[model samples]
Target chain A: MAVLTDADIEALGLTLRLATTVTVLLLLLGLPLAWWLAHTRSRWRRPITAVVALPLVLPPTVLGFYLLMLLGPDGAVGRAMAALGLAALPFTFKGLVVASMLYSLPFVVQPLQNAFEAVGNRPLEVAACLRAGPLDRFFSIALPLALPGVLTAAVLGFAHTVGEFGVVLMIGGNIPGQTRVLSMRIYDHVQAGEYHQANVLSLCLLVVSFAALLAMSLLRTRRHSRD
Target chain B: MTDSPHGLEAKLAWRSGALAFDIDLSLPAQGITALFGPSGAGKTSCLRAIAGLEQHASGRVSFGSDVWQDSSHRVFLPPHRRRIGYVFQEPSLFTHRSVVGNLDFGYRRAGRPVHLDRDGLIDRFGLRPLLERRIDNLSGGERQRVSMVQALLSDPALLLFDEPLSALDGAARSDLMGCLESLHATLKVPMVYVSHNVDEVARLADHLVLMEAGHVVAQGNLQETLTRLDLPPALGEAVGTVIDGQVVDYDAHDQLIALEFVGGRLWLPYRHESVGQRLRCRIGARDVVLTKAPQEGTSALNQLPCRIVAVADADHPSQVLVQLDAGGSTLLARITRRSWHELALSPGSAVWAQVKAVALGL
Candidate 1:
């Protein structure tokens, strides 16, 4: 049986890096979108919410297939990147980042949206009356009050990105130390009939994901009791 | 602070689904103005409009010279821009922050000079030990006390209270009542208070705006409005008269204070109010006894010579409510059909009103 190799170590590092990048990007992009989804009374609220939540139900392979086409060399985004003197995004580290962000969008946004909704209107009204403007109220009141939800979102987003396989497989074609994350390395090991190496990588993913989900559930229960 | 000579003048109209409001009121610039009405009467909506919290409301609101809202001219100042402090029905203290942090949220945003600084309010509201405590541990009354202190610390030019004490039980309500009274005495900020309880309105409001079905049926000085014979019928049986008086003397031996009004002197249970301090004494119609002539044998503390101004139908068909003009002030007396018929009461008949009891309103 092969011991923990340098290739496995690099794959682990790359997975963590991609998950971190994707989680950070999702939080930045998802917070305002979640806030709008939570509070808006507009006609578009339901449709927009449905679109943001589509990833949860859509097959990851199908999503990956579409994303592959979108980032392919004659695609609109691909051509624009080429015009800007940049390589096409597919099969690159940056391409994996984009794919992971989409895969984890629902994981980050749903909890945050629920958290913002749970804050209710009364606190914001009180803050407004207390001379807190919109931004001031969000940072001082909404953000802090919704902290538990934010934590859940972060954990779920990071974990989901870390364990992601189909989207990464389709968009991030195996490339050592670039887009060959742990899941991809595990796939490589299993296809080569190296069952021991595959089992090791798979166990690491299972343990980490389980720990993260356990923490999330514990956080949720604590929050519910506090309420 | 700018003197709001016109007090608060709002001509606001709001429509949300089936409930709609059309209100035009001019409140006194100083002291508390209680918006008295039943639920769904649009009292809160009107108050929210004045505070710039009701989005659908359109019209003008001018506090003295400053125009807070004028939809016609598109001059609408948002809530944060307007120096108004509003306390909601619930005590919405920041759960994540310590008490001191919650207080500082308003204090830091207060661009105007601090009227009551943090330590000063903490001392005044007895919140020193609670400064570092988390808000979740506070009782309902304690949370409301902190809320009041927070609003006061901001030094609001105009304060809006929407049933701030409704969430508290009897003891907590009275405790916050005392705090509110003291805060009103200290700050003297123009306040628009919304309440369904008539007792609260009688005790705190200097100006009264009566609303029903989304309309201001009557608005005037609290003393005058309460006594007005033609008040909106929606006021129902809570109708009473507010007699403005002063504590001329306190009979220490009798445990009563001599409250002298324009009509006469009423001896009521002495509170801690000093002599010469003004008071608003609420005498309910049910509490006033009508007599043809002043009698000396009765144990009642007050009897005033009054002329029957009008005899109106009471909500209960069995009773007739007689309006009496005692000297310059007005008094309401709910007398039975037997007494009304036996005494032969008329619009201009001479009579003496015996007030058996008077509840001191603030």
Candidate 2:
């Protein structure tokens, strides 16, 4: 009996592509959102914070269900996309990425928010007096000081997306070479009584999750020691 | 100095936590203008408003021809847009950067023509050796030096210092003060220094603004304002005279130098300053004694024949403050009520004021 097959390799590759795409998109979206959440003195801060933090407490299935409602063909976003000459997101790799982003939103944003908040007003003010404009201050002073937090956010985002199972199962139905990520693949193996294939894939995921956390911790330690 | 084209005029009105600021100020074109007051007296607020650091500060503020802030016209330039450099109470150096990094942070951003000599300033401030060091590794004095060098590197049109030395120990404080006094002779840009320290103010300020409880009690030339009798009652103890003159005579054996001004001459212990260089000193009112005639047997070495200018009540009920004019320079003498009555002194009465050589603050 073969311990692994071509299908398992395809699932691993697909899982990586989905996690990479979602992590990149989350970072791009999360940077500014975290900055605003950290510094804005507006009255909407509490409500918006609560909304960003919703994924932390809400079950992954709950988020996936709501997203499925919103991004399905009859849903608001799905209708808008369809009108703009786009395919419906459900049961596709795109749907998995979209759902994973919502599921891992807090993991990405919270760290970045804490990082930017750690860069308090004094350094920015000092930079301004040195003839740096607002944007210049943000890039040169605020962002660099929050580098560790940024790294933690990126790692957590990538790992959380990789480990996510419920949202991917609900909105992104199992489909080989498309939405059959490692976690869902393991589920399919267990259901089929292919214990050997399941063990190999599950070990891969376990090692990957452990490595991601260890990498984040090691980077944090090196940075603190260097400082 | 009045003919110089640049000056600062500001009217700051704002309210921050637990403090309200309502101050109107006019500073001269050159030399140091000190905003002197106690903590929570709005001295720092006045400097911040002038530098465009306080966003909510309203009313008009103009530096030279540049209108820094005008609420009615909706003209307000932020700190970076205004050519002003600010030094806070504590060194606000970027911790993530090295000393050189902090120095370059402003130099690279400053718009040309910089017109400032970077290496000379670094050398003057003694920051050359610590260029590669991290900010966290620097001592308090060294950090302040870096702050000063960093500010000067930006080539700012105006510099504002907010109690830059209050955080340092005595040795560091005097060392930085030495740098500032040396820098003053060669510095071209106008500066605003805020401090509650009398010695720092007296040593550094050519002009003074006395603040008390969010109000400007008096503002004038350092010499004129310090000798003013009608300053706020809380500042009555600061009543003294500032003298600026040339070192005409130096007796090396006695370690004394004769400082001669338009009015007369007084001697102070020499501190290695060569003759013909100008120096300044402050004489406290309480250090002077009044007598009807000059006494030869007195141990006091500084005696001047001065005509009385004014007599006012001092802070204590038993003492009186007498203003005297030794020709053109003004002097203040604090005497008891009994001495005032026995001498029968009135404005215009001629008398001899005796000041101890050791009492002069050089």
Candidate 3:
């Protein structure tokens, strides 16, 4: 009984790529959205905040069902993609990236929002008086002060995307070298009574998660001591 | 002191919750103009409006012809766009930056033709040893010094200070006051400072804008405004006289320096100031003693023959305040009810006013 096979290696590699791509995209998109959510006094703040945090409490199947309908050939997004000369997104690597991002949205956004709130407006006001424009102040003062929060958000988003299963199962549909990530592969192995293969893949995920969590705790201690 | 109106000209009307104020002011070109009032008197609001920080306010704010906020023209510049530096009540420094990094932020962002000398300012403000230190680790006074130096390095056109010393202890306040007084002497940019402290206002302000409730009670030259007799009844007890003059002579043996004003002179305890340096000192009304005749056996260093100009009721019923004219200068004397009746003190009554050497605040 082989513990690790060639298919397992490809699945883990795809999982890493998907995790990295999703985490990077979320950071870039979530930063400005989180910043706006933290500081805005507009009437839509509560509604928007609840929407962003919906993924945290909503069952992954609920999100996956809606996403599946939205990405189907006759769906609005699929129509737009076809008009742009592209294929439908379901069961593809790009589709997994998209689904993983939706699953991990709150993991990336909430930490950054909390960090931005902690930084407050006083330092920004002081920067303005010192002749820093809006964008300049954000990059120079707000970002540096919120560095610890940003690091935490990045790690959480990466780990969460790697661990997600339900949403990826619904949209990605277990396509090898495309969307058969480590989590889906482990599920397939267990269903086929390949207990040894499932155990090995499960142990790999457990180690990666443990290492990431350990790194998070160590970074938190270093930040606390510095502060 | 030219005849033309210059420096900051602001006509602002603002309301914050239940408190509201409308102030029309024109401050001078150079030197410190203090916005002095009690808390809730809109002193800080005036400073904020001038700095383009108060958005609720309407009307116009112009610093020496450069309009910062003009509601009429719909021209409202943001803080970074306007060349102004603001120092808050607390030392709101960037906690992420080191002292040197904070200084460099200002030095690099300032536009061309920077007039401030960075090295000399660093030495003057005693920030050499703390260059690499984190802002959070600095003491309150040290942080404030860094905040001020940070503002100065930006080469601002106008500097606004909103009770910068109100957060410090007595000892720290005194030390920072010394630094601020020295900085005021050399600062080329105009300043609008806000404080409720009478002593701080008297020591630092060349001009004063006094406020109460939401109104400007008085605003003019420091000496003229402090000596005005028709001040608001709420400020009756604080009525005194301010004298601005040069140190004409100093007697080291007696530790007294003779200060000459427009039409009179007074001797105060020496504090190691060189001759010919201008001094602005205040004398409380209660410190002036009026005698019918000059006493030779008195230890008081100042005795001037002044004629009674007017007598007004003081805040206390048991005392009366008398105004006197010693040639061209005006002096205030606070005396008891009994003394006023017994001496037959009236207008044109020539009397000798004795001012104690230590009673004058410099």
| lDDT (C-alpha) at residue A138 in model 2 | 83
Single-chain TM-score of chain A, each candidate: 0.95, 0.96, 0.97
lDDT of 1 at B168: 95
Q: State the C-alpha lDDT per candidate.
A: 0.86, 0.88, 0.88
- Model 2 deviation from the true structure expressed as Cα RMSD, one decimal place: 2.3
Off by over 4 Å in 2: A193-199, B2-5, B111-114, B296-298
Say which prediction, candidate 1 or candidate 2, comes out ahead on DockQ.
Answer: 1
Estimate candidate 2's alpha-carbon lDDT, on a 0 to 1 scale: 0.88
The better candidate by TM-score, 2 or 3, is 2
TM-score ranking from best candidate downward: 1, 2, 3
DockQ of each: 0.77, 0.72, 0.76
- TM-score for predicted model 3 compared with the true structure: 0.93
Off-target runs (Cα >4 Å) in candidate 1 are A217-227, B1-4, B112-117, B249-254, B271-277, B296-299, B358-362
Better of 2 and 3 by DockQ: 3
lDDT of each residue in A128-165, candidate 1, tens digit only: 88899999989988998899889989999999999889
Candidate 2, residues B72-132, lDDT tens digits: the string is 9999998888878889899899988999999988888875344778888889898889999
Steric clash pairs (candidate 2): none
TM-score of chain B of each: 0.91, 0.96, 0.92
